[model samples]
Target: MNFSIARRRMVERQVQGQGVKDPRVIEAMLQIPRHLFVEEAFQSQAYGDFSLPIGDRQTISQPSTVGVMTEALLLQGGERVLEIGTGSGYQAAILSRIAGKVYTLERIALLARRARRVIDSLGCVNVNIRVTDGTQGWDEEAPFDAIIVTAGAPSVPDQYRDQLAIGGRLVIPVGNRGDQVLMRITKVAEGQFTEERLIDCRFVPLIGRHGWQEGES
Candidate 1:
């Protein structure tokens, strides 16, 4: 399979065709090798317009979804970005290409380890992956320029809002476990944010203290 050709087709169709206009996001999508993030068995379908499981019941989101979410962050380079749910580290790699640094969290240890290995192999030195409950948000690295949550949550977690720098943007999917609306929140001032619904989407439940319990449906 000609992965480079497949990648360009993905960015042009699945990503740009989905209404993602950010040039940086488009370039990142083209540059990152999506096939390397998925398991060998699924590599052939990595650039397809759909999600792929990456073990531990988590999935690497579709390329278009990643592009849309990354675009909503409104990154202008040299910004610290926080990513909730590292899954396969594909999203973080894309952010690393555009942001100054990326701090990504994954609750599943095995998944985190796997994602870390792949990210390291790509030499994304600015990307940091930690095994922790992403719902709580990374307080030690508070005031992120942008925050992106890959999992679906019942509501926007307060920690995410509090940890966001004023003027920072947060893109998250909020709603029921089976369905959600993609939301773009911008912190305009202290304790003040403006929310915009971007699109309807779906994702696995975000499981953590501030999210759905492990046993909940």
Candidate 2:
């Protein structure tokens, strides 16, 4: 399969057709080789519009979803960004092209290590990956300009709200296993938040403390 051709189709039919108009976001999605982030068996489907399972039962999000979420960030060239559920590190890689600094967390140790290696090999100096429960929200790097939760949670964790800088935005998926809604929450002021629903989505449950507990796994 010629993955590059499929990738271009994704950009034109899936991403751009779906309203992901940010030129930078589109360019990042187009430039990054999504196949490198997935298993060899799934390389042919790398740029398809559907999510592909990676490992540990986690899946990389669809390209269209990634593009829309990135465009929603409204990055101003140098924004500190936090990403939860760094599956395959694909989304984080896309963010590195636009954000100033990206801190991504993963619950699974093996996936985190592999993602770190791939990200570093690509020479993305601005991205940092850690093997930790993402629900905690990287306290040392609190007050990020933007936060993105790649997995679905029953509700937005309070810790994530605390980590946001005033005027910052968090894009997260909220709901149960089979159904979820993508929501954007802006930190309007200290202790005040404004929310807008972006779209409906289906995502794996976010696993960790302050999220779905380990026992649930």
Candidate 3:
């Protein structure tokens, strides 16, 4: 199974085909061997256009969705990024390619450990993974140039908004339990942001403080 060919095709067909025009994003999607991020049994489907389960009931986001969400960040390189919900760490990997550094958070211990191993194996030294609640944001690393939230939340978390550097972008999925709209919020000034809704999508709930309760459906 030659993953490079599959990755190219996946980018041309599923990602680029969706009008994701960032060259950096396309290159990152091509460079990352997405198959390694999944279990060996599911590696063959890693480049597929649809999402796949990665364990602990979380799903590795589909290629197009990842592309879309990432492209929305408008990363210009050499920026510190905060990623909530690292999942398989695939998103963080992409972020690492386009940003100077990436800090990702995963609440589930098992997922966080597995993702760390995979990220380390890929030699993505720019990515830093932490096991903890995501909605709190990383205050010590306050004012990120960009933030990407992988989970769907009922509403945007206030902490996320507060942690953005001026003119930084926060890309997130917000709405209900089963559906969400991708939103790009740019912090133009202190306590001021402008939002643009991108597309309709679905993702697992963001479980943490300032987000959905752990047991909520």
Candidate 4:
């Protein structure tokens, strides 16, 4: 099957049809080869609307979910983005296309290694992947322009809020492990934030200090 054509259809039918209006996000989704981020056994279904396993007990978020989460960031260009959960590096690849830089964190070493190989193979140099607890929120690179958490957290992490630059946005899914609500939070000013709920989503548990503990999933 022609993955490019399938990718286009995915954008039209699954992503855009679901109400993701940002042209940049749509174009990024169109350009990235998501199949390369998953196992070859599942590559044929990579362009489908649903999420697929990427090993290490993790999954790539559904295409529409990635679209909605990315659109919520409203990235114009040249912004530093922190992606909490680099499973498959698919979301990071998308971010790399739309942002100036991407710092992604994944706890599972195997997953991180696999994702790095795939990302490097695709020449996504803007994405920097690290193996660490994502709940800490990459304190060394704090005050980011945007932060996207690809896992479900029980609540918003205070560290994430403190790391956002004024006018920065953080898009995350918050709720139980099996269900979640996507939230977009903007740091308008010091100690002042505005939040908007986007859509319902489901993601693996964000296991770390500020999220679900390990083995909880």
Candidate 5:
């Protein structure tokens, strides 16, 4: 019943306990009420160590996953970020606390609308949610300081790498539709990047050009 306390416990246990060392990531997990992002029926499980459905077959990534991905970005402060899957907009809400701005894209309009309402209600005005094919990467808003893809893709999308600013970090899951390896790619120079595998993960298929087609999933 006490959501605030539950949230802190989540950060201390599911997040920080998982070895996510970034203070900003931990603080964001502490500040945001995860319960608000899920449907009313599932609100009680918001702070649990698992993902919850947010409709449209999408999920709010588990707390530890969110922490790991966010920490991988290494956000110090005031950097522009692009989130490839808005889902419940919970990740965007978390990023809004540490990033200068968050541009999130969701392929499903209904999900986008729902995420927008929740994000707006939280007064996370720095998060911009748009309904679009995320695999394309927001070219008009190119050169993001950090890029995070919440879904699993068959391979790393070229558009994402092309749009990243030099020295920027991109955290994404790359593999089959049912399984993936979380990867961190840092753009060191034009057409040059270093990759690190963080963890094995499973996420919804990233459906779009340069990702998995609808039929493939």
Candidate 6:
């Protein structure tokens, strides 16, 4: 498969056509070899603008969603970012290209280890992946410039809001199973958050402290 051509079409059609206008986001999407992030069996499907299962019942997000969410972050170079799900490390890779440092957390230990290898193979030194309950956020590294959650949560956890530095932006999918809304929460001031719904999406439930429990699926 001609991955370059497929990625261009994905950006021109699935992403830009859907209102993802951030030039930096588009450039990162076009430059990253998404095929390298998924398993060999699914490499051909990498740029198809659809999610591909990675393992442990998780998946790499669709290309358009990744573009939209990254654009929503309003990332400027040199900002600190926290990613809630590191499935495949694809999204984190994209962010690494735009942000100075990316601290990503994955709930599944196996996924974290595999993604770490994949990320390292790509030489994405700006990204750091850890296995932990993301619902708690990375408190030790709190006050991040931006926080992005790749999974769906029943509601925005208070810890995520607390971790956001004033003026920080958080992009997350929130709601119940089978139905969810992508939301951008902006921290305007201390203890004050402004929420805006961006789009409807379906994602694996965010699991861990303050998140959905196992068997809730």
Number of the top candidate by lDDT?
Answer: 1
- Among all windows of 10 consecutive residues in model 6, the one with the lowest summed lDDT is 115-124
Task: Please identify model 1 stretches exceeding 4 Å from their true place.
Answer: none
Q: Which number leads on TM-score?
A: 1
List, residue by residue over 35-123, the lDDT tens digit for candidate 1.
Answer: 99999999999999999999988899999999989999999999999999999999999999999989999999998898889889988
State, as a TM-score between 0 and 1, how close model 1 is to the true structure: 0.99
- Give the poorly placed runs of model 6, Cα more than 4 Å off: none
For candidate 5, lDDT tens digit of each residue in 90-195? 9999999999999999999999999899889989999988898999999999899999999999999899999999999999999998899999999999999999
Q: Please provide TM-scores, in order, for all candidate models, with all chains considered together.
A: 0.99, 0.96, 0.98, 0.97, 0.98, 0.97
Where model 4 places Cα greater than 4 Å from the true spot, the runs are none
Clashes of 2: 0
Give the count of colliding residue pairs in each prediction: 0, 0, 0, 0, 0, 0
The per-model lDDT (C-alpha) reads 0.95, 0.91, 0.93, 0.92, 0.93, 0.92
Residue 179 lDDT in model 5?
93
Which stretches in model 5 have alpha-carbon errors above 4 Å? Answer: none
Model 3 clashing-pair count:
0
Candidate 4 clashing pairs, residues 3+ apart or interchain: none
lDDT comparison, 2 vs 5, better candidate: 5
lDDT of 4 by residue, 94-147 (tens): 999899999999999999999889889888899988899999989988889999
Q: What is every candidate's alpha-carbon RMSD to the true fold?
A: 0.6, 1.2, 0.8, 1.0, 0.8, 0.9
Q: What is the Å distance of residue 28 in model 3 from its true position?
A: 0.5
RMSD to native, candidate 2: 1.2
The whole-model C-alpha lDDT of candidate 4 against the native structure comes to: 0.92
**Candidate 4 at residue 30, lDDT?**
92
